[model samples]
Target: MAKYLLLIVEAEEAYASAGEAELNEVMEAHNAFAAEVGALGAELLGGEALQPTPTATYLRKTRTDDVHIVDNPAPELKEVVGGYYLIEAPNDEVALAAAKRCPAGFGHVELRPIWSFG
Candidate 1:
């Protein structure tokens, strides 16, 4: 079996700026989707809602063995990676199916293959 990462991106400020009722509804939708994914026998390894983009840090390496670190996300955008799920699935198709059902709140879900050293 292979493990996949379902990265959920969202506009943190936009979400937080919404009305209380709207925020509640959005959260409910996400929770419901998570429950559905769990029912499919996919293991939810771990996930967390990240702090706003302002708190993010970026790092890069150069050919001369130089490393650069910055205090911003790469390709700045209104939406940033808010959370993620590590799941075991039979194939990419199954992982994509789950990603499609994620409640992104006008954002996006990126499905990436997890690289295993073993």
Candidate 2:
């Protein structure tokens, strides 16, 4: 089987304004999506929900050859990666099909195959 990563991209404010009930609903949808992927013969290897972008830290090399560290660097970005799922499937078709079942609510899913040397 081949591995794929489903990147869950959503608006930065998508979850910030969500009520408790809405969050629960979204979680339930995610549970159903996971089950559906399994039913389609894909193995749900791993996944996680990320903290908001404001909690992120970034490191960059400046032109002066110095490493600069910044916190909450991209709050201006309208959309951010909210989570991801690592899955193993029989082929591209299966992986793509499983990605379609991901619960991305007001955003979208980006599916990329994991590179393997062996």
Candidate 3:
């Protein structure tokens, strides 16, 4: 078995333009999905929903041996990483199965294997 990180990205419009009722519905669905994933015996390490991008910060390395820090996200896109999940599964297929059940409106879920150091 291996641990994978499931990155959940939500369409900016779905989030930014969502009303309170719509947001509540999405959140309810997400919670249900999470519970289902947990029942599958996959370890849920941790996860969280990020705030809006306006509060994001960016940093980059410069050729002058300096690190330039900025006050916003690197790129302005229609989608933003909203949350993530760390799960243990036998293969990518299983991980993907869980990710597909997430409540993201026309959004996407990316699965990446975690590198174990030990």
Candidate 4:
């Protein structure tokens, strides 16, 4: 089987404005999504929701041999990555199908295949 990553992207502002009821509904959707993928035979390897983008730290190497660290990666980027899902499937088609079933809620899900030595 091959591994795939479902990168979740969403607008943080939307999340901030959502009420508790909306959040609960989103949670239920995620639960349903989990059941749906399991029924489709997609093995969920691992996944997690990340903290807000403001908590992120970015680093880069400078030409002068100094490593620069910045707390803000891109302040102007309105859409930020919210979470990801790692899944294993027998083939690309199956992986894609599984990704389609993911409940991104207020965001869009991007599906990518994990690099394999084999």
Candidate 5:
């Protein structure tokens, strides 16, 4: 099986002021997604929600050994990676199908196959 990373990309401002009920709905949807994906044979290795991009630290690297850690990316982006799931699937198609079922209510999902060098 191969590993895939489902990057949850979304606008941070939307969730920043989410009402209590809205938050509950999102949590419930996530729970349902977890159960549904597991039934489809996708093993969720690990996943987590990240802090806002405002809290992100960007490491800028150069060929001449220049490196600097900044608060965010060089060109600030509107959408940020809010969360991610590391899943193991039978193949690329299966991984994609699993990602399609994930509950990314207000935003979209990005599925990428993890490169294994061994």
Candidate 6:
């Protein structure tokens, strides 16, 4: 099985203004997706719902051999990674099918294969 990372990208503003009912609906959808993974014979290795971008801390190495730190990515980007799911599937087709079912009401889900070096 190969590991894939499903990035749940979403518009921050949409979630920020979501009401209780909307938030609950999204959560329920995610719960259903998790359940579906196992039923589809895929292994859900791990997953997480991230906090708002403002609460994030980013780091990068500068040309001067120093670590540059920031709070988030480009502020101009309308969408940000809201959550992620690490899943192991039999093939790319299965992973793509799973990604299609993931709910990203405000944006979209990005599927990426994890490279193995061994």
Cα lDDT tens digits, model 3, 33-99, are 8788866656677778887777777777856578888766556677888888888877777777877
User: Could you tell me the lDDT of residue 83 within candidate 3?
Assistant: 80
Candidate 5: residue pairs that collide: none
State the C-alpha lDDT per candidate.
Answer: 0.78, 0.90, 0.78, 0.85, 0.85, 0.91
Q: What are the per-model C-alpha RMSD values against the true structure?
A: 2.7, 2.4, 2.4, 2.0, 1.9, 1.8
Q: List pairs with backbone clashes in candidate 4.
A: none
As a TM-score, model 5 comes out at: 0.89
**Collision pairs in model 6:** none
Over 4 Å off, model 5: 62-65, 74-76
TM-score of each: 0.79, 0.89, 0.83, 0.90, 0.89, 0.91
lDDT of 2 by residue, 1-118 (tens): 9999999999867688999999999999999998899888899999999997767778888666788987666667677899999999999999999999999986999999999997
Report the lDDT of model 2 for residue 63.
66
Model 5 poorest 10 in a row by lDDT? 70-79
Show where candidate 2 strays beyond 4 Å.
Answer: 62-65, 71-75
Give the number of colliding residue pairs in candidate 2.
0
Which candidate has the highest TM-score of all? 6
Which pairs, if any, clash in model 1?
none
- Could you tell which candidate, 2 or 3, scores higher by lDDT? 2
Model 1 agreement with the true structure over 1-118: per-residue lDDT tens digits: 7899888887787876799999899889878877888677565666667777767767777555788886664666777788877777777877778788777875889899999897
| TM-score ranking, best first | 6, 4, 2, 5, 3, 1
Point out the higher-scoring one by TM-score: 2 or 6: 6
lDDT computed for candidate 5: 0.85
